[model samples]
Target: MRDPRMSAIGKGLRRRGRLMVQAVSPPRRVAPERRALNAVPAQRDPRQEAPGATPAPRAPRLVDSPVFVLSSVRSGSTLLRVLLNSHSRIRAPHEMHLRTVHVRFSRDFTADAMKELRLDRQELEHVLWDRILDLELRHSGKDVIVDKTPANTLIFRRLERCWPNARYLILLRHPGAVVTSLTDRRDNPDHAAICDEVLEYAEKLEEARQHLDHAHVITYEDLTADPERVTRGLCEYLGVPWESGMLDYGSHDHGRFRPKLGDWSSTIKSGRIQAARGADASLELPPRLLELAKAWGYPVD
Candidate 1:
């Protein structure tokens, strides 16, 4: 027979070991609904749900019919942006380069990757543009938004694919003048490369005009020569009443200049719309650019 005291001690140790094991063991999983209910409500929150119940679904996001100002750089896109922004219902912001963002997304466009992500090419592109435009509209507290990304002309097809109802304002400037402005800002003396860029931009713009049904052409020369007349026409195209104050863009706050977006926009800071001086007569245009200018309705001579 075992000693009584030793038997008691053995029983005590067994009980303690059992208690320790239970303490360290993982707890049972709570249901998803239960977990959601227990989550701490965010600060100043109004919504509340019963414990162990599903929360209400959120409302779908609203995206406005956007107006795009498409053009090549140094072609008066910035000036037009300021003029539109001055309008009461329109909020035109600086270049947001949505096309660049779309290009980045395209890198991962393989079939398998898209399947894994649960989004097709069009779906992904739509989501990106929608989110950007929605944020801009909310921030500006405006009913209509105008985005002026000069390179956007190159991606008009893609934009149409995403926002079929979106309207476009295509701004055209003399190719020679555009290149002159571009080269003036940079130290690079290679006029050939700059000319090539201008021609490519014009080609894309022409293509967009041909394919898109809702595009309106606005020449930079005409815009500067008669601000009121050009802007009134733009308002008619946009289906909004033209505001007289739009002519005084200098009085409105267009926000600070962003150097990274493009330094060519610095002229808008002058607070007044100046008449467009003729392009430097001495600046010679490459043969390709000269031909493009003539085709686009700008005189080469």
Candidate 2:
């Protein structure tokens, strides 16, 4: 038999010869039809960290990929949602009211509804976020989703823990007006006591500021007076392109939430400013509320 050493040398030489042939040969030109199918032209989406065409090594986390709009109730969050919804890539909810009622009502709702609704404690914390992203993909056929819930601003610290990459757009209305709007009901006529609710919101907001890193605040007055400028600033902050029609969200019919059968529905449909700059002047707020506003950096005028 041939020596074992000789056999190994011949095998190595044969492999080298094959490699040399490959290096020297002219590449076979692909047919026109084949070339078209094979070509992958360079395309980019600045909003996406990577093009959807690229396969991620692993699935991204739910929280890491969601956009959240956080603020107190009736603080121009509806307007913000309208603007954001105008974007081709964004789908938003009108008022999810998830945080306020989701967790708070978890125990009250029957365990059967809880199980059937798919809202456990963890899911409740991120209900609007989950629904916005999932529905945008299904209905709006977009990847970017806007969760424009006002109470989210107060409870974001709890949310941030679950979704560190959650982005926030804060809506800051005049405290007096916010309280006025909330406390205007005939049964809820305790104007001074309403300060407790406003103070609680401020306390939570301050806590959110201390704990969360990815947040920006926009005042309601600034938005109404210069919607284009404010909306553009918000887009820039979120690394999105600003579109002009975002100012006209009052007309878009996403049909997410139906206002109750009452003045609330009529008021929302009217799209008029419910609270003006001096709306609080006619109402009597407790001195404690004025003090709380002053302490929280809200002008007491």
Candidate 3:
């Protein structure tokens, strides 16, 4: 038999010879260019972003000399829209709730929410209102756009901020008439709710009155009583020449109904501009609303 010691010595020699061969051979080395290419890039501060990186999105193009009609709901805003749209120079579309749109973007105008969403209040307003009014102007082929959203009375200050040069046409109606009209449109009439709305409308109208330079108040009663005279005066306020066609709103094609807007404007869809007579003769005004109605030049005996 072979010597066990000799077998062990032979195995050790083979292991040593393999080690020597590996050591003598050149160690595997990455190419210099490959090493440079494979090296990790240096970290960059986000604040010091690379030049020519994507720029922040720009705000939308705003309208020139934009006109807005402000009022509470059921205050003849739809009539105002049709009358204004009838003018050759002005294009007034259906109620575009721009304030509500702004609220949707900013979520109650919270600074933290706006910051997180990467939007500024004025920027959001510009983007939304611009897109809407611009589209309306294009469609109507009119020089200037008039937005007749009654609820805009609530956000008149915000609108001023968005368009410092904007002109406002504020429509005022008797609180009883407004409340009665609103109640009629509802499936269930909630007196307390209607009272609250009347109070809110009064408050907003008062707020709007504070800015008399930009705002022109017209009573719904007067508008219905004298559409020509009232609309002509409105044209003067807007710095536009009055056209006779404005009185004939039924002749033109006002667009389809926008159900997104409240139901108070159902009559305007007929494209007619007849005055509503005795519409509010039946509503008994609450004392609080009666007091407000008197303050707003409404006969509330």
Candidate 4:
């Protein structure tokens, strides 16, 4: 009984199986994986070995010379940067926060202590160094490259470890007023945290004074009220001649000056400060903070 339907079904089944077999078969056989492909072996660069094993070291960084203005957030650091940059011989960038960068490279940091948050150390350092060089080139490489990162106020020792010869400028403001400025932020989740940071900065500065010899402390009030006196002192400290323009900082074109406090550029553009009114006022400080501030020779009142 040769059923025509049965015949067709058998033929279809055979065809399907053959196609399945073909699909399962391996494509063309590839030559045994090359030894080089089997593993990633180190390959020496021919050019590198031909003469000098290493490319001539990058032209030494534009200059190893780094000048840092260390202070706390909301402490008139931006104003300091603008005033210093007004000097034709100096390029002071808005806060680069080098201390925040340095601490991440270190392991001895106490998470519970006063040191503020850390940044990506290697990347931040590289970016900052590049920017410093760019500023140097722009200014014909004459003046110093100053970085006014407030976080650096707490981490000066760490920075000196990374750049042993770096110069430091310590800027201090009254703690009570600094806390008041921080508390104005009604929406900030970490406003209290900021207040703590201000306290931490005061503590670290005390620790810093014991080890830092090349640093000169500049009170924010002094710099704002009597810039001539403080700036002259700074120039003398740096061995730079006092420039008249430094005294008349308000007239300088700071259109390009970047304020680290975000868009608060107008706050500093006027170059007028209210800190001076209380500069000589004797305000109560936490007993500990008071001791530290006074140790730095801050006016007790």
Candidate 4, after superposition: displacement of residue 78 in Å? 1.8
Top lDDT hit: 1
Better of 1 and 3 by lDDT: 1
RMSD of each candidate? 16.6, 23.2, 21.2, 18.0
Question: For candidate 3, lDDT tens digit of each residue in 140-253?
Answer: 887888887766777788677667678888788887777777677666577676767777877788778766565788988898888889988998988899998988888876
Q: What is the lDDT of residue 285 in candidate 2?
A: 62
Q: Write candidate 1's Cα lDDT for 1-301 as tens digits.
A: 9999999999999999999888764755643312422333222111122355332232223564688887887788888988999998898987787765531232433534654656544455567678888988889888888888776777787677667678999898988888788777666456776677777888888787677766888899999999999999999999999999999988998877776453345467887888775677788877877776787788878
lDDT for 97 (candidate 2): 47
Best-performing candidate as measured by TM-score = 1
TM per prediction: 0.73, 0.63, 0.69, 0.62
Q: lDDT per residue, candidate 2, 1-301, as tens digits? A: 8999999999999999999888765756753322322343232232222345332222235435677776666566776676677776677756554444333342344434644654344454355545545765677776677777555665676666556677777666667887777666435355654566666666676566556566787777878788788878988987778887776666666564444211244545665434334346777666765765575566776
lDDT tens readout by residue for model 4, 1-301: 8999999999999999999888764644332311211222233233323653322212234456578776766677777777777787877754554333321322334322312333233334544665655665475444677777666665576566546667888888777666666555334425445445567877776666666776888888888788888888988877788897875667876455543432264566665544442432333456666666677666565
In candidate 3, the residue pairs with backbone N, CA or C atoms under 3 Å apart (3 or more residues apart, or in different chains) clash, namely none
Candidate 1 has its poorest 10 consecutive residues by lDDT at: 41-50
| Sliding window of 10 residues with minimal summed lDDT for model 4 | 31-40
Query: What TM-score does model 4 achieve against the real structure?
Result: 0.62
**CA-lDDT, candidates in order:** 0.74, 0.61, 0.71, 0.61
